[model samples]
Target: MKRFLVAGALASTLLLAGCASGTGGLTTGSVDSISAVEPGMDSGMVTAEGLKTNADGSVASDASGSVSTDVSRSVIKTASVSVAVDHPLEVAPELATIAANAGGYVQDSSNSPASEYQSESIYVTLRIPADKFDAATAEVLALGTFVSSSQSESDVTLQVTDVDARIASLTTSVDRLTALMANATNTADLLAAESALAQRQAELDSLVSQRDYLSNQVDLATLSVSVIATTDAAPTSQSFWDGLSQGWSALVNAGSVFVVALGFLLPWLAILAVIAFAALVIIWLSIRASRRRHESSTPEE
Candidate 1:
């Protein structure tokens, strides 16, 4: 009787120990199954038996920990680009629309006045979806000639990781408070638990919102494009009445030139006039001398 009692006591102790050790929640009755689970896994309402591995090395039930991800994200990213092109107003909006289709927006836009002989110019700033930045930039380049372009990138990986860690801590605190609420024996305790839970939840919400905002900033790129177009001079034609008036004015100018040419020969005309005067004087003196000599010769006869 004593031996049987001892044996029964040992059996009960072993069963109780196994339950306390949580062996029921393991695969093949092994406690190492807990080690297989990863942190941040949402394992709610799943049975131990359901977690057993199959012959194919796959879990019999869905386990988020079964897969691991290496894709990490940055909290903030800042990039700036400057480009020069032709026809900014026309090309800028088109580029802005393309950015929008790719999940971007136009922040600002401006255009310079067209010169009397040249085309207009445009300047613009655009926000683009992170994934479509490269493609959209290539399309903008196709709009006109490239004068200058520069790109820069910044990473906030550490900040993002820190925020995620805070979120996790807040979540754990909330979980603990939730578990405490199930066993609250007094009104004061229950209120305290609820208040802590609310605070943690609010903190978590803020962290999530900030992280999302920062992630978006990093994911998208901004491009500032300036456009300049070459302008050609246009020719103008004159009317028939204008042409006739110009020709008549030219004829009048020719007559004035002929009058100037004749005035330049006035010295030669003056010399000829002086010689004619001298010859007339000589003839008059000879006529007087002949008359006087004839009178004197007739008297002598």
Candidate 2:
């Protein structure tokens, strides 16, 4: 009987311990469930298991492994390139075609014809998709001699994250306000909820606009290209009218240079004139004094 009681007591103790462990696990799971659905969590924070949305509003899993972490980075890219081409006008059209093929567009362009003295040149600004920036730039660079190139990037990740957070918070606020308005009992409560909703909606709209603008800057890479014709590409001959126009322009330019030179020399010329006048006056006074001395020495003749 003593053995039986001891065995029973041991079994009861084990049973109690198992029960306690199960209870603890249940409590922990309940807490986790509550936290998972808790309000005000920043859903914009990308995590290893985080899913991203497609443009069509469909949920998609990240397949690029660690690349998803960089998805949140908002970088604005821009480039300025100076290239020497044999024909700038010809290159301008080719550049436009290249941009079009790259799913880009020419934002602005200026093509100047080759003159008798000046070489033909073109300035074009393109807006290409960020994904195609490198390829587009490479193609553009290959179109002509690479004179110089520079690129710039700005990280707006923090700003984008902040705006997203604010937008989410405001969206929650608006939803709450809308719910309150729906459940409002009195006129005063209804009016107040409406006013709050309006205010929150306005703020949400502004933040969304800002986010969109930032997104556009990240999505489109701006590239400014300057194509200059080489000296060898200059026109070798000119018609009579072309010669006359060139001569006229040269004359005008020469006159402008002459005026500028005269303006620069005017001050020096004035100083020299003053010095010369002073020297002349001194010489004249000296001669007059010498004559007087000679007369005096000549005994008042």
Candidate 1: the clashing residue pairs are 77-218, 85-227, 85-228
- lDDT scores for all predictions? 0.59, 0.71
- Could you tell me how far off, in angstroms, the CA of residue 215 lies in candidate 2 after the best superposition? 1.3
Residue-pair clashes per candidate: 3, 0
TM-score of 1: 0.45
Instruction: Provide the lowest-lDDT 10-residue window in model 1.
Output: 25-34
TM-score against native, each model: 0.45, 0.55
Q: Which stretches in model 2 have alpha-carbon errors above 4 Å?
A: 1-71, 115-117, 232-301
- Which one is best on lDDT? 2
Off by over 4 Å in 1: 1-79, 83-86, 100-123, 228-301
* Ten residues in sequence with the least summed lDDT for candidate 2: 26-35
Candidate 1 per-residue lDDT, tens place, 192-252, comes to 6676566556656777887787777777777777676633212156689878987998999
RMSD of 1: 25.8
Cα lDDT, model 1, residue 172: 59
